[model samples]
Target chain A: MKIIVCVKQTLDTNASIEIKDGAIHAPGSARIMNPYDEFAVEEAVRIKENQPDTDITLITLGGENSRDILKTGLAMGADRAVHIIDSDLDDFDGLAIARKLYEVIKDREFDLVLCGRQAVDQDRAQVGPALSVLLDIPAITVVTKIDFSEDYSRVVATRQIEGGAERIESPLPLLATCQKGLNTPRLPSLKGIMAARKKEVVEITDLPNTAGSVENDAKLRILELSLPPQRKSAIMLEGQPLDMAKELAQALREKEKVL
Target chain B: MTDKSSIFVWIECQGEQIKPVSLEALHCGLQLSESSGQKVCAVLFCGSKVPDLSPLSDFAPHSLKVFSHGRWQDHNSQAVSSTFFKMIQEQSPRLILLPASNHGKELGALLSGLAQAPLASDCIEVECLGENDFKVKRPIYSGKAYASLALEGAGLHIITLRPNVFRGESGSATVLPEADINTTEPESLSLIVREVIKEAGKIDVTEARVVVSGGLGMQGPENFGLLEDLASVLGGTVGASRPVVDNGWRDYSNQVGQTGRSVSPDLYIACGISGAVQHIAGMSGSKCIVAINKDPNAAIFSVAQYGIVGDALEIVPLLTAEFKKILNG
Candidate 1:
């Protein structure tokens, strides 16, 4: 089985975001592989562990820095990597990116494709389902549990929904976007890190030009990026715990009326 | 097809009634229609038996479009997407608004892909720039930053509005036209839903008016009983920080953080939460926040409207008792 795992490099969640000159400042921000995509890579590696013949390939689309994330995926045990490098590509929306991804990997022979539920940067969660549509395959999003049939012809997946879960079944050549609680992703060992240095990374500089449709035009344009408005200073209530509790209760009833 | 412009809203049904988020989207759609001089159209996908559409009459949409397919009763993304896709092809609406629910997000992405339309997801605000143009505000970088996006093109503009952000409005009851029902099965569907396991009778934290959230300071799952008591008194829901969920102290559904659900409740009480950026991103949008922790320097106090520097274990029960006294009286 050949598996393609989509990975993206994102600003570390711990890093404080800063907007400068009408755009998000990327410099000085620590960039790591999107936290959710790590789960996808981990799941793919586990599948390779179970089926020794399974081949895992990591694919990414970003600027020059994206190669680092692909290399990190390689360190986590993907067999190879593909980097579609174009700074202009960053301006495209999720659907265009999905179309480009489909254009790149449509002819490749793969039994399964995996992606993160959503990128922390965009928080769109659109590419995986859009990619599945472009590829004309079945997709299940926010999947937490996946089980393959003994013959490897079908898969049963448990996906997270609002306030509940749903068990779904689909045939092979399916796509699933990973969510948290799927599995604990393992860090790359030193040996694996050293081996990743020699892994192959195929880079493409330009995307295929099938671009006359209205969808090919960038629909969503970023006008400005700004920090969220800060809240007013908190009123620290002083007194004994019981007294404070009474005061808070009175405030909720009298002021906030939320009680 | 007529050249008349219309704004379409996807009215999501939960059992017999409309979901609050979908109603909120309808409100947003109505606002957009008023601003752009377009008509408001509500689309409801149903099963064999149609839901009670009388309640929607209070919102006074110009028309209601019902697409009934047996498979739609269950939450099938393929069926919903195909139905909406067919409708979009038939009626080229100027804009499409959907709730930012799980099904909505999936269907939005699927329809965008199938129709090659552009989508703005989880938008907090939407503005009609002109006839076929829109400007939307959405939180990015885990709510730390807000990005203003402009959608301009000849094709359809799609947006998934976040819940609780838009205020729902009701006008004088106007009898709406009979829903135009279309019963068409999707051509091909490879996925099958085997079973659905729902968490019964639990107030979702995202929709809760009040939320009592615990964190690492919660110590263990047993300590959550105090929070449950407090939540019950406040008629609210219980939530936990990501660390608590990661430690297996609570179900993932109760988690509030960057990876989990973003909530904008009326009142949010944080107990022992240290307020990491990830956790803060989820609840900072609350209208009023009260933080209770032993540590005076806990970051949660920064965004909280009120702070009590004390032991949560001791204070939560006291607050619950006090609230019960005041509310019951």
Candidate 2:
């Protein structure tokens, strides 16, 4: 079995994000693999543990600093890493990014492709599904659990919906975007880190010129970016627990009218 | 694709009723149609037996198209997107609106890729600018900022609207004439649904009118029972911050944060929550917020309309008992 996992480098979730020059600037923010993508990498590694013949490859498309995440993926047991370095890639939208990813691995023989449900930064949750469409494969998003059939020909995936779970079975060569609760992503062990240092990191510079490709052009253009309006300070209710509860209840009924 | 005109809204139906978010999308479509002077078309996918379409008549859509198949019982993005692709090829509507549910978001992305259309996901506002253009406002940077985007293209413009933000309205109860119904079975479905397990009769945090959420301050998993009690008393739902969920104190579905469910309930009560930016991103849209934490400087207080600097373990039971007495008496 062969699996391809998509990983991205994103700002740490705990970083205090600030707005500077109409864009987000988290000063001294440490870059880590997307928290959700770690689940994808872990799922791939677990599959390899069960199926000894399974090969896991990590792919990422970004600038120079992106390889850090790929290296992290390699340390987490991915067999190899593919880095598509394009300095001009920062301006691409989700759809264009999916198209570029499709261009890179459309011909590869893989039974499954996995990605995080959504990146923390953009929160679009579009890339995996769009890439699946481009590759003409079925996609299940927000998947929490996955199991392979006895023959490894089909996989049963449990996906999270609004208030429930849906169990879907798909044949091989499907795409699944993983969500939380899928598994506890393991930290890279000392031995794994040592092995990763010796592994190969393949860098590719052959990207199709997206200028002539109509489908590769960005569909949505950002006209302006601004921070959300600051909220007013909370009106602190001072009193005993009973009195505070009474006042809160009264406020809910009289002022907020939510009760 | 010759000068597209009509606005098509995807109406998600389970059994005989339309989903609330889909109704909101329908209302959005109607509003856009008023400016575009285009017909508002409602697209529904139903199971083997076609459910009653009369429930949607109150909204007074110009036309209703039903896609009935056996496999439509569950959400199959591949099958649904295929149907939508065929519809787009046939009608070529200028605009497409869908609810920003899990299925809607996935289908919107799939259709956008298949149709090569510009898509705005989880949009809070959308306006149909004339001449094949639309302006949309959506949260970016994990709700830290809003990006005003313009979709200008020759293809369909797709927008998935966030639920609870768009107001739904019903027009005169006039039945819409049924347009062409497609009964084609999805071709070559690679995915199959094995089973669907749902938490029966429990209100989802996303759709709940009120939410009572806890965080690391809740101390442990058993402490969430206090939140559940309060939620039940208030006829609301129980939620948890990412840390609580990460600590295995609660299910991921109950997590309210940037990476979890984004909720905009009428009232949100944060108990013992420190209010990380990630968590605030999800519930900041609530109409009113109340925070109860021992720390006065908790970030959650900034967005909270009401605050009580106290221990959640002590205050939650008292608040729950008070509400019970007030309501019961």
Candidate 3:
């Protein structure tokens, strides 16, 4: 079995992201492989653990810094890493990005393709399913658990539903999106990190035409970004605290329709 | 007035009733259509008898088209996508819009492939940049940030707009030409939905604006009643963290996180919840977040505008009573 996981590099959640001069800036914080993508990498590695002959490869497209993300994947036990570096690639939308990634794996034969449900940065949640479309494969998003048949020809997976869970079964040559519950992502061991330095981190610069006819780049650029408005604590109130709270509550219910 | 350049709104239906989001989509479609001087039409797909199209008459458009396939009684993405693709190509609508729900996401992505167009999924806003050009805004960085996008190249733009960001209006019902567009269904080979596991809930979180979510600090299932009370007071919904769901304090459907349902409520109140990254991914887009946790350093507080370090059980009742008074007054 062969698996390809799409990983993206993004700013850590703790970083104070701000837009200055129309560019989002992440100061000082080190970039990490998207946490969601970690689930995808873990699932792919787990598949190989079960099937000794399995090979897991990490594929990503970004600038040179993306190599760090690819290295992280390599440290997590992926067989190899492929990075399509293009400084001009930042403007591509979800469908275009999906097409480029799909083109990379279209000719090669792979049993499964795994991706995080959505990158924490983009939040589009389109690439995985869109890639499934371009590759002409079946895909289930937000998969919690996936099990293969004894023959490894079919899979039984659990999908997250609105309030509960739904079980789905799909055959091989499928795209499964990973959410958080599938498996615990393992930390890279000392030996693994050392070995990642020697792993092949091939960079492809030639970009394939995304087959899109409209050349609409980002048109709605942010003029300025600012923090949200501050909300003040109006009154803590006195006497029993409960009575004042109730009075304030009554005033809110009566005056404000939000309740 | 019928225009050569038209905007098509994909109306989703369950049996004979139209989904609420579809109406919301129509409202957006109307704005785009009117602004671009293009005729706006509602395209509805149904398995059997065409649903009540008249209920949607209040959302008047240039026209209405109903597509039917008897076999579509079952939920099949390929069948629906293909049907929509063929109809869209035949009509040559300049732009196509759908709701950014599960079905819409699947259908929009698939049709984008079939039609060879760029798709901006889960967008909250769309603006006409120029003649037939659009700039779409979508949330990025989970709900922590947003990005504005513009699709260039294809004349027929395909997109799935997020709900709640746009409001639905009761446009004066206008009648226009109706067209029936249906195409052949694709054969399914490998995947089949054996059975549907349905979750029980009065309101879906995706459709609710007010949500009361609990985290691990709630202790156990018995304490969830406090959340329910607040939710009832607000006429809102209830959600839980993965831990709470795992503890059986709330149903899995009520779970909000990366692995759970993503929600964009107007007011999200987190009680005794330590905001984990995964949990924040689901509700970070909420308009306002109120965090009630004993630990002031909880990650949830970073994103919460209002934070109260107190017992959830103590705060919830007071909050609920306060809300009830506000609402009643």
TM-score of chain B of each: 0.94, 0.91, 0.86
List ranges where model 1 is wrong by over 4 Å. Answer: A211-218, B1-4, B184-188
What would the per-residue lDDT of candidate 3 be over residues A1-259, giving only the tens digit for each residue?
9999999887875565666766677779778888779999999888888898998889998898889889889999998988988777754467668878987888877999999877766666778877887788988777888988999999988876443455778988999888777888999889889999999877889967655443332222332333323344323234443664565455434553335
Quality class of the docking in candidate 2, CAPRI style:
medium
- Native-to-model Cα distance after best TM-score fit, residue B108 in candidate 1, in Å: 0.7
Which digits, one per residue and each the tens of the lDDT, describe model 2 over residues A1-259? Answer: 9999998888887776777776678899899899889999999999999999999889998899999998889999999998999877743278778878888778688999999998888888888998898888889999999999999999999998877889999988999999998998999999999999988888989888342132412267888877777789899999898899988988887788888
Model 2 / residue A46 / CA error / Å:
1.0
Candidate 2 local lDDT, B46-93, one digit each (tens): 877877666676676788888888878676778888878888888878
Model 1 TM-score on a 0 to 1 scale: 0.96
What's the true lDDT of residue B179 in model 3?
59
Of the true interface contacts, the fraction found in model 3 is: 0.31
| CAPRI quality band, candidate 3 | acceptable
User: DockQ for the candidate 3 complex?
Assistant: 0.32
Model 1 fnat? 0.76
Tell me, by lDDT, which candidate is best.
1
How close is every model to the real structure, measured as TM-score? 0.96, 0.94, 0.86
Instruction: Note the residue pairs that clash in candidate 2.
Output: none
Worst 10 residues of 1 chain B by lDDT: B1-10
